[model samples]
Target: MDRPRCVWVRKADARVPGKLPIVYSKSYAVRFHGLERLHPFNAAKGKHIYKALCAEFSLAEGSFYEPEELTKHQLRRIHTRQYLRSLRWSLNVARIAEVSLMAFVPNNYLNHFYLRPMRFQAAGSILAGKLALDYGWAINLGGGFHHCCSNRGGGFCAYADISLLIVRLFDQEQCRVRRIMIVDLDAHQGNGHERDFSNWDTVYILDIYNALIYPRDNVAKLSIRSGAELPNHTEDATYLRQLGRCLMQSLAAFRPDVVIYNAGTDILKGDPLGNMDITAEGVIERDRLVFSTFRGLGIPVVMLLSGGYTKASARVITDSIVNLRQHGLLDLSPL
Candidate 1:
């Protein structure tokens, strides 16, 4: 297979010494005459997180790496051509975005306002994955569309970004990274990647999600190496304990070259969609635990901001990232 001309594959422009491997772009924000506001998924989630990280780190916008929009040719590496064609219809995009009103919008307008932003985020995921090999850690302020797979999309996910990232690395960096593990801490089960990687031994999935939520795909559960299904309103103590045990077990069972951390803030208390009760401190500690565990072992980690709703999600994520820096898990200084 011919490699797609992706920005991540180009090294000189990919990273700078001492700079954090944080991928983002203004194109990640979806805007369609304010119609995005009706959707529960924050249309500007990446933009908000980017601003917060800039303030917290006292960094200029140039400190971050920006990815270009993913072309259809690049998307075809994993997604089916028919599935890609379906997105050209407004009704299909409306269903994927969970915004029923978008059905009436013109497909061209939706392509510009919604799909274009998704393409940028999808490219960011691929960039962050490649950066992790160089920096030992990287974060994409956007991405983690875990509900969309190679041929299907749902739960406000229009692209299979996580799958794309995994495929890109496995294809381009096979010598360095033969095995990949997905640690999906999103409130919803990451059915997308699970379905895509099903029966593939190289990819190990460890998902912790509310069993009662949307896209309860029992079929996809077959791909998960370790999984914890939680009930509604489950608290942080229980969530974290299960997570710790699962992490240890997963590590013992299968060692991975890189870990994909889908850190979703939807588990926060009172989230309309997540339906869990994890506190802000709990979420911060959760991030610290994941980072310390992997980074301490010299394993590379690439983080993606997944399904977080509510206005406070951005603050919670920003705080969690700061806590990781304080713990020294984000240090990229040369020895």
Candidate 2:
């Protein structure tokens, strides 16, 4: 007696004959008039990355996958009813978004203007997870909302896409995926997933982050199977060494059916939020290292864009994708 497969994955919402395994959508942008400018995040981050991929890889707008908006029932798979209801209040949304003006905005328009983008990105993450199982690698231009867990949302993360992706994979049983490893190198601890999978032996969390950053969750630190606490303004050599050692050690201890790489560019130099001094080249190599490692093992990998406060994050992400292509890690040759 086998479990039912995920119907969502059976449907074709992600790829075409020519499209790569990358996932993205135009609706991923947060366009609340000029209010989005308040946050250091570039509202058009997904769009810019899409354009860059198009230029570099010669892909068209149609070549990318556009995910459907996640329904409330779908969200309930990971988020509790109480947490979901809390989002109805504009005040809570304002706090999560870090935008005070959102409190005054009409609650009716909140989902249409702001939360919709996040929901779409969440859906994209699920799609990417399924695609990774088939293609060996998949990249969602938006997602990695790691700060939000099952019962809470914070640090500009309104959804627990990471948890949902793993849960969906496990529940669906469409992809023989039981042991999942999360490699969160986002400069801040991924307390959301940590809290959700605290005692789950199947989920291995390897989180490398700054010790002095936001959401310094001591409780969540206990869940990290292997990670490092970096000092402020840690440079390339030290960061890469720590990452290399952690990856090698964790893989030797735990074997995962799938790898979720939270490729956050906030660790870049001059990032006001991440507070690390890793250069642009460091970021590129960081992505390459993660991709090459898991892909070399014949294990499927899914990469998600998490937190990057600076506008230059878009370019850095674009360049990194190109580097991945150049290194023969990303196969746009239609697998």
Predicted model with the maximum lDDT: 2
Off by over 4 Å in 2: 1-15
Tell me the whole-model lDDT of each prediction, alpha carbons only.
Answer: 0.90, 0.91
Assess every candidate by TM-score: 0.95, 0.95
- Compared with the true structure, model 1 gives a TM-score of 0.95
The stretch of ten residues in a row with the least summed lDDT in candidate 1 is 1-10
Model 2, position 1, has a per-residue lDDT of 21
Which residue pairs collide in model 2, if any?
Answer: none
Give the distance in Å from residue 63's predicted Cα in candidate 1 to where it truly belongs: 0.2
Per-residue lDDT tens digits of candidate 1, residues 81-187?
99999999999999999899999999999999999999999999999998888889999998999999999999988999999998898788866777899999999
lDDT of 2 by residue, 1-335 (tens): 23355444444443458878889998999988889989877778888899988988776668877799999999999999999999999999999988999999998788888999999999999999988887889999999999999999999999999999999988864547868999999999999999999988889999999999899999988999999999999999999999999999999999999999999999999998899999999999999999999999998899999988787899999999899989989877772
